[model samples]
Target: MTTRDTTVAVFRPDDERLRDAVELVESLGATPVADPMLEVRETGASPRTDADYTVLTSKTGAEIARETGWEPGETTVCAIGSATAGALREQGYDVDLVPDEFSSTGMVELLAERVDGARVEVARSDHGSQVLLDGLEAAGAYVHETVLYELVRPEGAGGSAELAASGDLDAACFTSSLTVANFLAAAEERGIRADAVAGLADAVVGVIGEPTRETAESEGIAVDVVPENADFDELACAVVERAAPTYHD
Candidate 1:
């Protein structure tokens, strides 16, 4: 009898996130393949002083705000998810709101109800969605944005193209839209975009959230699973369940 070794490609941006994905993959008995497609770096921008409310869409945004020595003061801080709210709390800022749904659209809906005639500051990466800002503006709130971080593809990331096109991977996990976009960009750069896309079509494509799943679909890749919660452990479980039949065969 031969034992099957399942490989799961992890495309998280930074080391901290990659570590979590790797651990989850190992826990599910799958070999973890690091295919980091994006790198997060601070943009050295501070929180806006002219805003009455602040919005954070990711934990990285919260960390960037804290590192820049921005004081929340009386400004109502809104987060998109529990993890982002917890990060703000760790920095001693009282998070005033967190939407039940952890997406920009969800944040917009939450703020639309309470942010009329207010000035809002959106702190996030350079690639952050404009939906929250536009929605707030439509809801009668003046909005400003601070790009606290930037997402860039790491140098020499095309090496993963071979692995991605090899058809040996059992699953691929994407944590963000940028990761999905960058992965395809790297594959295209290596002249293996078609193979990579075909290989992924044959494998289970797991995304951390609906936004990423939508991005994958837009790029012509069919997604197989998306966890209820946008967490690495949940993504791991989803991938493990999808790959179980292959492992046992």
Candidate 2:
């Protein structure tokens, strides 16, 4: 198999994210199928005010906080992963804590041991998880959650479903659990869920972390690769590694 024979599906919503995935796929000499599964729309909700600490779970959350002019003055900032931390730092917020595992459970463990009787604000998407709120509450922290954006499946996601059913995808890259879920949902809507799952099972499925891998597996799609460091570049490399025999031989 050659570069022309290797086709990868990049399922991230935002243009910047899609571009990054495309570039990574190109760098690996593979063709990228850009079909955004979800789109991010601002919710127009203001960030919580006067909190002792602020939590950001994704890059979208950090971007929303920056665009909304939310200041973290003297407040401890916590991020779920390095990407989120980098996004927060770009917005002039110093990330005080980043969990080693880069997941809600990881953040919970870190905060449960350190944060007590503190007011914490969580900024995330409308479909964000309740794990942080529940975990923080159980750890004795008052958590104020605000939805900064909404992750909705785009109307033209059927292309992805078709691609998945075509069985032409050599690898599929998923950055978040929502991406995996939305892709499966799109396939389900098109009555191609079984074919989509089979196609993904036949290809190299690269996930950013364990959570995304779990989500993909839960949808009956076999995940072949998960990067050690939850990053897109690493995920892309993992895909290339998994597909190497097809292209290299």
Candidate 3:
């Protein structure tokens, strides 16, 4: 008999990213469950203008910074990843540095040699990692952070939890640490937390990168795939390929 159809769950915001995720799943010949786990709340805050170096960690942060008309001026600009760099460029901001690896650790590594005695401004979300701040400080830079946005789980999430609990899901793609936490929160709200976690143990669970994988595993969710590249398309493609190997158009 033909295998059952593949169904992949994605937890992106309820914006264009989710739409793109749905289309990507469809293109991969798997049914998409678009359950947004996180919502963006802009904080109306921008990075300090007097920093010798400035770091932005997300596309959302970059967009918000540009919207606030925050100029980089003479500050050396840094991005955590290519996506953030691209966002800065699209917002008419020139980016000076992007780490070879797209992570807090990578950002620290890239700046560890140059930021001695410099004033560094890190502007991102409320969930910004301490690793970045601590590393910069240890390297003799005075690092300050501004919260550009906060990520809160949307109200009507967790549909995918039900699907997973019932064994209807083939795979899941988690993009960030917050997404993993919010997904569990949604599952708990639906009273299927245990079952959902058990079901995921049997399914192909893909996370975007090391941090997300650590978050998932810390929650007792066995992550099955993590692409070398820390991006959605890479995560989705790797998950879909594993979940729908025999799927035909």
Best-matching candidate per lDDT: 3
In the range 182-206, model 1's lDDT, one tens digit per residue, is 8889989888999999888888889
Q: Compared with the true structure, what per-residue lDDT tens digits does model 2 show for residues 141-212?
A: 989999899999888775656777888777888888888888888888888889988888778888987778
**In what order do the candidates fall by TM-score, top score first?**
3, 2, 1
Residue-level lDDT tens digits of model 3 in 35-128 = 9998999988888899999999999999999989899999999999999999999999999999999999999999999999999999999998
lDDT of 3 at 43: 85
Candidate 2 weakest lDDT stretch, 10 residues: 240-249
lDDT of every model, 2 decimals: 0.83, 0.84, 0.91
- TM-score list, all predictions: 0.93, 0.94, 0.97
Model 1: per-residue Cα lDDT at residue 159: 52
Worst 10 residues of 1 by lDDT: 1-10
Q: Cα lDDT for residue 205, model 2?
A: 88
The whole-model C-alpha lDDT of candidate 3 against the native structure comes to 0.91
Q: How accurate is candidate 2 locally (lDDT)?
A: 0.84
